[model samples]
Target: MSLFQVQGLVKRFGGLLATDHVDLSVAHGEIHALIGPNGAGKTTLVHQISGLLAPDAGRVLLDGDDITALPMHRRVAKGLSRCFQVTRIFPAQTVRDNLLLAVQAHSGSSFRFLQPRSQAHGLYEAADRLAERVGLQGCMDGIAGALPHGAQRTLDVALALACAPKLLLLDEPMAGMGPEESQQMVQLIDSLRQDMAVLLIEHDMEAVFRLADRISVLVYGRVLTAGTPHEIRSNAEVQAVYLGTETLEATP
Candidate 1:
């Protein structure tokens, strides 16, 4: 079974149907990319998936359980974690401390019988692992906000990893990054399939082509197509609707 599934989701805003019967799936160990032009309802779909917005119809199933009415935090507990377009790291804190906090939140009963110091040590180990996972070990002592833009985004990804997610939701993780930073982020994302499935929402077609196992095209609040990278690249309809009109990258 798929690790995550969005079935016939529907949402509206008074006069507008922002999300119209959208269906999507992310399988275990798959990197599924979602791409579309502006106002295609990608953000709206993500908000519903992340529990930031409620859907008017359809169901969200994570690991065979329904989570449509669950709140954001509840969804996180169920192994659904998201990284937003904007970085969401604790600015004043050191990267180590930020990761420590995230680790502690998900530690649950594992540290219950241990003394405070032992628990601290356990949290520290988990934090260090997360830092290492994202290539942020060198920046662990650095203040999160003071780091370079790319590093800050990387830290935000680490924070989400703390949840030990089964499905990782990444929204525009490479936004506001330079070419070097974008490359680094791409590598970090590529490495994630070993641990969990990723549902990526991004406009960077170059990265999408390179990383996605499968790509889903969203147009006018509906899925226009879903296929492998080569198939998507070769699709005439996709090129006409999106790739043709888009440069797919920004100034480095």
Candidate 2:
């Protein structure tokens, strides 16, 4: 069964329909990718899914619970986490401090009664674990803004993971990375499917083909096709659309 579902999702900006009755589903342990050309409204669809924007008409269900109308924070609490195109971190804070803040924000209330010093240990342990999960342990003491671009992006994913989400939304995770960094990100994102389903909106065809279990091609605010990587790669209509642009010939 699908763990996340978006039904008849519609979003409008003036007379232009940014998202047109779009429907998408992601199963547990699946990496579903959303891809399209510029101006295809991919980002708008993501905004609605992540609760960053309210849809004109649609319902978002996570684990069978409706979250379409909830605000961003409420949706996050409901196991919807997003990693944005830009790195969202405290520039002056160390990696450990940044992870600690995120962990504390999503943590339960059990530490309320504990002594201050004892609480510190628990937070530190959680922070360390998060860092290690994304291979940021070596740079735990590095300044957040000072980390290399790839590491900053890795840290961004770590921050999203801090929420313990069931469905993780990755928005152009490899947007500004070099070839090497992109490769590392692909591997990191690949690892995430072992834990939770991912709804990835990315422009990098290579990464999408490499990591996606299911791929949905969007055009003009609508899903043109949805299928496995091999199916999408071999679709004639898809090729026709991208014929003037780059070919989707990358191997996973």
Candidate 3:
């Protein structure tokens, strides 16, 4: 059975059909990539799956449990987490402080009797692990906003990891990244499938083809087709509508 399922999801905004009976699934440890042209409703579909917006019809299920009506935080509590397109971090704070806050938020206990959070051994250790996990161990004391763009994005991913989710929703993680940064993120995302299934939305075709176990194409809020990378790369319909003729002309 699939670890996460979006069944017949539909959403509407007045006359615009933003999402149209979309069905998608990610199996255990699978990296499923969602791709589409601009205004194709990829963002709308992601919002519904991440609980930022509710679907007008159909269900969002995690491990076969209906989460369609759940709020965002509740969905996170139930092992679904999301990283936004823009990196979200505490700008002025040290990376360590930012991580501590995220760890504390999900740790389920307030500080006791004006006690310093730094005195909490477990939080510090957990925060350290998160830093190492995202390759931020050396920058723990550095200001979050001062980090390079790719590092900031990596830190954002670390924040989502604090939730220990079963399925992670990554929205355009490679956006704004140059080739090197994009490659680093591609490596990081590729490693994550060992621990959790990932629903990735990205426009970087090379990275998508390199990492995705399966790819889904969307157009005007509806899924056009889904298949392996080779199938997508070779499909004449996808080539004409989304990938473009020249984009894959050089590819075998």
Best by lDDT: 3
Sliding window of 10 residues with minimal summed lDDT for model 3: 109-118
Cα-based lDDT at residue 244, candidate 3: 80
lDDT of 3: 0.93
Error of 2 at 77 (Å): 0.6
Clashing residue pairs, backbone N/CA/C < 3 A, model 3: none
The number of clashing residue pairs in model 2 is 0
What residue runs in model 1 are displaced by over 4 Å at the alpha carbon? 109-119, 245-252
lDDT of 1: 0.91
What value does the lDDT take at residue 85 in candidate 2? Answer: 79
Candidate-wise lDDT, in order: 0.91, 0.89, 0.93
Candidate 1 per-residue C-alpha lDDT over 112-180 given as tens digits, one digit per residue, 9 for 90 to 100: 424576647868888898898999999888999899999999999999999999999999999989989
Residue lDDT tens for model 3, 8-90? 99999999999999999999999999999999999999999999998999999999899999999999999999999989999
Quantify how close model 3 is to the true structure by its C-alpha RMSD in Å.
Answer: 1.6
Compose the digit string of candidate 2's lDDT tens values, residues 39-126: 9989999999999999999899999999998999999999999998788999799998788889888886343425585757878899
